[model samples]
Target: MGTPKQFLFLELFMQLLRIAFGKNMVCYWDMKSSIGYRYSKFTSNHLIQGSANCSHLVYASAHFDAITFEIHFPQHDPPLPIFKPKTLKQSHPKLKVYLSLGGDDDANDKYDQLKYLHLMEGSEHAQQKFIIRTIKFLKLHQFDGLDLAFPLPRNQPSQQSNIGAFLNDVNRMWGSPTTT
Candidate 1:
């Protein structure tokens, strides 16, 4: 049997081995967890852990290469951050933080998030506006990049092509100082 500290070291060792072999060590910190969602234990009645915080990652920052903060598409022109990431970035200067867009928490919703994504893709003006606003949002929040987490609809070739085009457009404008 290994002690808690020994197990922690073993976990770190395994993470290093995986990284050495070129495996990505990415972590997604959901907004729900960040805003205080406690996780309970399955067996017996006991609380396992509290909401996730930057301190949790700061302690074992070496194990992660990047961390993605999940957020939904903007209802307005520019998206707002659910939590401030300045402290985390300052604590671990080398860690890359990304803003993940387009995740659905409710499966029972009549229209999927993909519907809105498709709508945005259909209109060139909408796509351009979204790209511009997203870039500014990333710069304002000090995000390393954007992660589009929108899942492709089944048997929708046009939607897939549209997403590709959107990605290309974003990449093109990402290097520009002003995308107007």
Candidate 2:
């Protein structure tokens, strides 16, 4: 949701974009997951300064049915903007904008090895909090779905039940919006 304060300004700004670029306007995902972008640095660009923080956010948004903004667990506290209703309203209403999880492999690389894994392997309290916060963040951000991009921890005997419970709770609460 967007504040009423953003309505007039957002509409006007979007309209200016439409006029400037016409129907052929170059679309893009301006907001980004900082950690995901950093980790994806390629060998070709290793010596060069990367153009900007967010890539893979195609500018031509209208051509796609969806756009996903992958969020490292730490990216969204409540949620981030540019994904809010006012911005999405410019796109096809049916467009699916998802907030994906688990870009922390590199994020946690410097510190705790299983930072993302903690959400899966930690105490029930931490795990549940992660799940609940994720749900709340998505709703607040007007995200259409959740993407789980991490592999489950290896060789944990209890993971079968734990994962099942996690899936059940997320599915029960989130329905089709939750994707593996």
Candidate that would win on TM-score: 1
Q: Please tell me which predicted candidate would have the highest lDDT against the true structure.
A: 1
Model 1 worst lDDT window (10 residues): 58-67
| Model 2, global lDDT | 0.44
Q: Model 2 — which ten-residue stretch has the worst lDDT?
A: 59-68
With a 3 Å backbone cut-off (N, CA, C), the pairs that clash in candidate 2 are: 27-59, 28-59
Candidate 2: tens digits of C-alpha lDDT, residues 1-180:
334555456556756766776543332332333213434422222111121212112311111001122233333554433335325434344345555454333343433434545555556666555666666666776666666655445686665456666666667756645422
Model 2 stretches astray by more than 4 angstroms:
1-82, 104-106, 151-161, 175-180
Error of 1 at 40 (Å): 6.9
Model 1: CA > 4 A from native: 1-14, 17-19, 22-24, 34-81, 106-112
Q: Give candidate 2's root-mean-square deviation (CA, Å).
A: 13.8
lDDT of 1 by residue, 1-180 (tens): 335676467567756655676544455554433223233111111111111111222111111011122223333233323444455555455556677755553223445435545544667776666677667666776667777655456686765656667778878988776763
Candidate 1 CA-lDDT value: 0.48
- Cα RMSD for predicted model 1: 9.6
What's the residue-level lDDT of 160 in candidate 1?
Answer: 69
